[model samples]
Target: MGDQKGEVVGGLLDSVRDVAGLPECRGICKIMYGNLVRRIKLLSPLFEELKDGRQELGEEELKGLELLKRAFNSAKVVLISVNQGSKLYQAFHWDKVALKFHQVTEQIEEALSQVPYEKFDIPQEVREQIELVHAQFKRAKLKVETGDIQLMMDLNVAQIEGVDPAVLKRLSKKLQLMTINDQNKEGRAIHELAIASGNHGDKIFEMSSLLRKFKDCTHQDSLEFDSDEGERSPLKHRSPVIPDDFRCPISLELMKDPVIVSTGQTYERSSIQKWLAAGHHTCPKTQQTLLQTTLTPNYVLKSLITLWCDSNGVELPKKQGSCQSKKPGRESGAVDCDRTAIDVLLKKLADGKPDQQRAAAGELRLLAKRNADNRICIADAGAIPLLVELLSSSDPRTQEHAVTALLNLSINESNKGKIVNAGAIPDIVDVLKKGSMEARENAAATLFSLSVIDENKVAIGAAGAIPALVSLLDEGSPRGKKDAATAIFNLSIYQGNKARAIKAGIIGPVMGLLRDAGGGMVDEALAILAILANHAEGKAAIGLARPIPILVEVARTGSPRNRENAASVLWSLCSGDLEQLKEAREIGAEDILKELLECGTDRAKRKAGTLLELFQRLDAPSPSSLEQKSDA
Candidate 1:
């Protein structure tokens, strides 16, 4: 217990210096950090005094030391998190950050109160200073600054108004997101934060999405916000409050093709389609048990919606099929033609026997594949979990169709979250391990789609998917190898998953794919290797695989992307290792690198340039040799 207390005191002192040394912050963080650093500095002398008297302290003082350690640690985390997070994220989440400050300050004051400072033989000035600081902290109230609120409002306005240059320019400058380069740096930072956050929640993902909008806005070459083909308006950002009667209850957008369920509740065709497809036997609005699954078209509601749109200047939701001659631009009522048929198929999926289930799954797979809107309709109807459940069916054909349907549905960004949240990773991994070749291949593809979201990477890796993916990479058919390679590459982006991939024995198959140039997985294999090389364990494993000669060869002769990756992997291996550098020199890689300096892509050239400099250092005379020469 004494040793632990000493360690905590030592850590707290170091953290104090770290917080003090941090650069000046802007906005809400500036105020919070200023107050915190000032208060924590007052504890420095108190902490030093404790270190000297720790052996003589009583039990109450020791408990107070533990509480002090926790308070300081919480302060350090809050300060660092605000300093390191995306500046825009800090501004937008000012309320949360302010609450953190309040909580951390209260914690410090409470810890101070518990400590019997008078018992220790501390200097009179220091003790009074500590007490005064504690009193100030106890009285301090953290409030969200008006500037931060305006900054958040500006961000929302820019997002809603479709890339207002003035708004973006002002907000970007304020948020320090001025250039495309700055945006990229913040993007990488957010990705790191997301991985570090683990399964904490959606906050990091929201930061990523907000940053993406800033990138899009800044990347535009012109001032005009194109609403038709470029920078299309998001539905939520539209200014008008859609009438309650005109909006679909499930989707809350203007109902293009409104239909009434048995409980007399109206919904957009796609929304209702999604709800029914999910196998719900009750009305979504009232939760009343559905008497029958029949959907009656509300033509009067549709006419009213059209009149409202005309009066309000809001365009009605467009149709998705072949244009009708009578309406000129409007789609023929092909969706109406399929509505009854889809209703029957959804019933078969929910209540039909095994044969019917198999047939229905196959058709839904085709429908989801045919159009993006159909995918939305299917997913919103809650078909994703049903499809995930079918992945475990005893019938082989049913399992194949079910997994394939999920793979198709996973293409939609919203459906990706739904699929993952529905507890699909373990089942998908099971399918990848034991299902038929096609099912396994589609399962791999589905995993890739789901892993597109950063948080899903952690969940998928934890579900024991890496080993099965490696097995597929080693033995599956050509298409299967490609799918597995993509999923593995994406999953390995998170740091933990990178180590998992290495431990799963991925190096052997990756080397095999690299050597078999005609196997058509060279691009995929190289991409995965580049990501894995970023990890320390992965670097050691790839180095032991004796890949220097192959990497050098690819850097010399492969396609642009492959050459870039080869250079990256080589640099990672040879950066600090003298043995790898010596091997590269002996393999005659110098001449190829010099040629790359003149003709390669920007990134490839950068990596090649770095390697050449390392080679120069390898040949450069050491300081000791220079000293010996002077003596001679």
Candidate 2:
């Protein structure tokens, strides 16, 4: 028993540091060794009997030895868990952690193989505990291997797909994957093993409490905060009551990483991240199930809190949330931070299985939305093609998520070329025709962003996206209409695209928008009509539709920008065309133009003068025509 204690049990505890280069696990080794040494010191006069050539242990000694071995072995299991978990602070090393899990499980299985309880007739309860540890290990290993596959089966909504090799290579850089379920399971298994060991179970590791030790531990990258009063420093003084809006409902403390879930409830980013990381698909406060996990940073709320802190002398929350870019004007550090993270997420989005890909899509969308820099990094990492591929996915929800991501990326002007080169226009066009209403709206919005480039405008125009755009303007929701109008305005900048837009019959519907459009939509709708009216085909459509009355009213009452657009379209219609002049006169445009000329700015007055001058020239009768009318 003494030799077993010195060699096998001691060897197991010492091997932990050697097996992994984790600095976090080093402290636990000392605690495990101390526990072993204290247990060993309880025995006395053992060496004297062994030196006298006593061949076997007495009954009491043998039972004590079995108990000691079990204690050391159980302590070894706890140390292994601490080893695994301390490195699990960030998801960046999950692959490494997974390998460690395999090795540690193998190590425990080997150690458990040494306990010859059946041959030695150890106590039944102790034997049962050891058996229980083995069973728990098996259960944990099984869970790690199969959890992902099961999750995929549960969430997979379409046939398996094969990704393009070139696209895959572009995005296949290994990144830290988020693996909450597996990590939580591993922690649980070790905690259960420690409990079954009878004595070692109550000891807590450094940050996470095993069932008894790690209760209510909050983990951050490279740091952990203990919520328990006994675990933390003694409270010196109570602070002021934090504003209810400032506090996260999940943590009920100050929101450090303040993020808003789909339900519009705000929680600390870390708390919500853990909730999502644990694969729960509902809000903690409302219990309303979430369809998509998009945690937008509540930057306004954060700003208010910062201002409140400065004004009241209360402490500001730590700058832990991804959105709270603490250092402004330091572009290099921000870009460097974003580049590595975007690479990791892109890799996961490109190469991971269905559930992982979906999760990565949702996460990438959220991150890209946080700031312009993140979007630039995501686009530069060749995320465009992978997102384009996801856009073609058969799953409706996946399609919307992919569309949302593409829309986010397309906001960066540089990503347009990548998306266009990948021929995303075709898929996006398909989405406009067939996707869900939200997907359709997002697709149209993406098209608006993409068509801002002159080259992409021609490409989208060639892809026959104009008809779908026109249809959206006619029948889509309010936001969809605005997006479509913006896209048409961008597309109609070129003369050929104008012809294409006119061919799609955009003039009448666009005029309908001009009549009642509010907010930014008013300007965009007016611009499309003005561009269309410059062409002969479009002028006839607008003249026949007879929106001159609406134009006259808008030129008089709309915002300055809208008035300018309205005046320009009217100028195109009325200049040198007697028929258009007649339409303008019948709609009382002359009087409105006269009023605008008196009160309008230089641009509006210039346009009104041009219209009024054309009306004067068209109204003047020729001398020969007047003489002929007098003779008759």
Candidate 3:
């Protein structure tokens, strides 16, 4: 029976070993489940204490224990099956279980390597318990495989159990070193990879190209900025090159219409001349710089001289060659030096002081010449009434100079009426009424100068001056008649003087001069006829007084100039009454029309045609009268 029981035990052990050697059995269950539960009964006390205390395991620990319990239960079932006397199942069961025990030991080592000892506080008692479990598992693994119970007893479970603190510290330092070393390795690997691929060279080339483009753009931008800055600078700082002294002093602009001053100095430009001539030689406020001897003739002054000479029908002097000189101041007195001496003496008479005035006047009378400025100077000196008083001088020379100066002074229309009102006209008329032919001619010329003013025309007409003027037109010299006819023409231009001319019986002398057809009296006659035609009452009086018939006769038989002037007068008369149209046409005005057509301007032709048409329209019978004549 002892022999039989040993065999049974051996068989049971063999079966348990076979089941534990399966490939899936691991951890404590693979190594120690048979011995701890059945052979040694080592887990009995732990199971009893856990049941009594109701000790709870952590979730991770419980998961590990549950895996162990499942493995043990699977081993138990496989052991039972092997013990059912299946030889093939029992054949490699011990080797298989031994390999599984080694696998479980490796798993335990791997689990301990990964476990965080920092999260747990294991007591000594628990540590010892775990050590006993490890020892039991290791001993059972050896005994089942080799059938060596003694080797099972030699197993050092404590060595396989919990970690030593020193070992744990070494592991922590190793892990930290590994982590830092990994970071350094990664950095070195990336740098080497960049160099190997030529990517770093490409980045350098791209940066260099970008820098060159940026420099070019900046250079262009700087040039544009400088150009704009220059454009924005001010223009006032740029100086004009005109000379300062060239500017005018009076207008402060440029010089125009300059004149000459007669003090004692000269200037380069004419501004000073104008200033001095206007009585501004010394500035009105500053009173400096006496401007004189400057010659700047204005364009208007030159134009006035040309017009005066042309209108007077006088010939200007030709340019003379330089005279061959005799020795200074030595001359034969036989040459008639009157012309040169007269010019010099006239200048002195015009501008000389009062002491030299009479000597200059005597020289002017000897040459029968006068200067216009002498009259201006005398008038400026308030000597006009004195000159008028001298008109009655017994000396013909004094009377001639006085009348010439008065005539020149009265050339201005304002001064003409003034002199006439100052009781000069009656004196002037007495000369024309009674003096010698030379006196009459001078008086007539003076009256002609005065008659240009409208007020003088009326005044002289009222003073009974026209009859004396007309008497000269018949009996006086050609110059006297010219002057007298001019006076008559001027007086006749006025409506008031037209009646005065007729009442003074001066129109008869004017017509007599026109009848002579000499001495250029035609213009004066046509002018008187025009003035008469313009006045309605004057036209009627002229027609009743027989002047109209004389005008009609001139229009019929006179020269073309006379006929044109007569037709113009008739046109003016026609404006007053259409009845003048018949009288004008009856005087052979159709000949005037034919003459106008042959020679007249377009305007004159049109005007004459219109007048002829008006005359014909008036001559035709009226429509109402024609109806009455047809009934008769």
* Best candidate, TM-score: 1
**TM-score result, candidate 3:** 0.40
lDDT of each: 0.78, 0.61, 0.49
Task: List, residue by residue over 370-484, the lDDT tens digit for candidate 3.
Answer: 2223333334444556556656766665666666656655543345656776689888887778777787787877776676555676777777777787678779877677777
Which candidate, 2 or 3, would have the higher TM-score against the true structure? 2
Root-mean-square deviation of Cα positions for candidate 2 versus the true structure, in angstroms: 22.5
Determine which window of 10 residues in candidate 3 has minimal summed lDDT.
Answer: 192-201
Considering TM-score, where higher is better, how would the candidates rank from best to worst?
1, 2, 3
**Candidate 2 Cα errors over 4 Å, as ranges:** 1-344, 517-520, 625-632
lDDT of 1 by residue, 92-168 (tens): 67777889989999998899889888887788888998888888988888776666766778867865636666787
Q: If ranked by lDDT, best first, what sequence of candidates would result?
A: 1, 2, 3
Model 1 TM-score, 2 decimals? 0.49
Q: Candidate 1, residue 90: CA error in Å?
A: 51
lDDT of 2 by residue, 1-632 (tens): 65644443344334333333333332222333233333223221232223334344445544444444444444444445444432212122334444554555555454445444354334456556556655554444422334323323322221123323232222111111123343344354443222211111112121122111111111221132223444463442334445668765544456776888887889877666645542234466544446478989888998998988887788877677444575454554656446776778788878887756876787787666544568667776778889889887777877887888887776555676788888799999889888888888888888877775667888888888888889898988887887787777767877788888888888768767766655435666776787788888888777777777788888878876567778988898777677777977887888888988998756678999989988887778999999999999
Q: Which regions in candidate 3 have their CA more than 4 angstroms from the true location?
A: 1-370, 394-397, 409-422, 544-563, 572-587, 594-610, 629-632
